[model samples]
Target: MPTKQEILDLHFMDARYKLIDLAAFLDRVDRHSGEGDFRFDALKAALPLLLSEQQGRAKAVLDALSDPSIEPIEKATTQGASGAPRPAGVPL
Candidate 1:
């Protein structure tokens, strides 16, 4: 099984690759299209905001991990229809 750090490293690399791929695709669209194209303009405007939000979320996760005082997430529990407690996992 991969360690936590290994999983984080892989996730970071994947994020970088995805950003690069998005930029390349945007560049291709910009090159082949008119300067005033709405699609390109909208994407260009949104990219920075998207990147900033992603960075903020990543930083928050790292901060939470590194803070020793922060509690780990407990195994989620929920009451089933029969009124019994059941383990649950939240999807990200």
Candidate 2:
């Protein structure tokens, strides 16, 4: 495996850019006015994984945003997925 410094040297800038992008996206969302969004809730739910001292942070975060429902719906609600599942009991 590469040394910690080596890993940082190769990928830190890209990670920095992505972190900034995510921050900017959150900022933009906060500037808008509307009812709560479930997709945004998923994004918020996944943020803590970035700070976690655990392996598989990527998978954990992806799982956080994933649709946990096992059964398929009988009909289409919209044209396509909104990228993440809505939290249960929340209105759209």
Candidate 1: tens digits of C-alpha lDDT, residues 1-92? 99989988879888789889988997777688455443344445444555464547554433333323345446534432221111234121
In order, candidate lDDTs are 0.52, 0.86
Index of the highest-lDDT prediction = 2
In candidate 2, stretches whose alpha carbon ends up further than 4 angstroms from where it belongs are 89-92
Where's the lowest-lDDT run of ten residues in candidate 1?
83-92
Candidate 2, overall lDDT?
Answer: 0.86
Instruction: Report residue 31 deviation for candidate 2 (angstroms).
Output: 1.4
lDDT of 2 by residue, 26-57 (tens): 99989989965788888888899999999999
Q: Which sections of candidate 1 miss by over 4 Å? A: 1-7, 33-36, 51-92
lDDT of 2 at 30: 91
| RMSD of model 1 against the true structure | 15.2
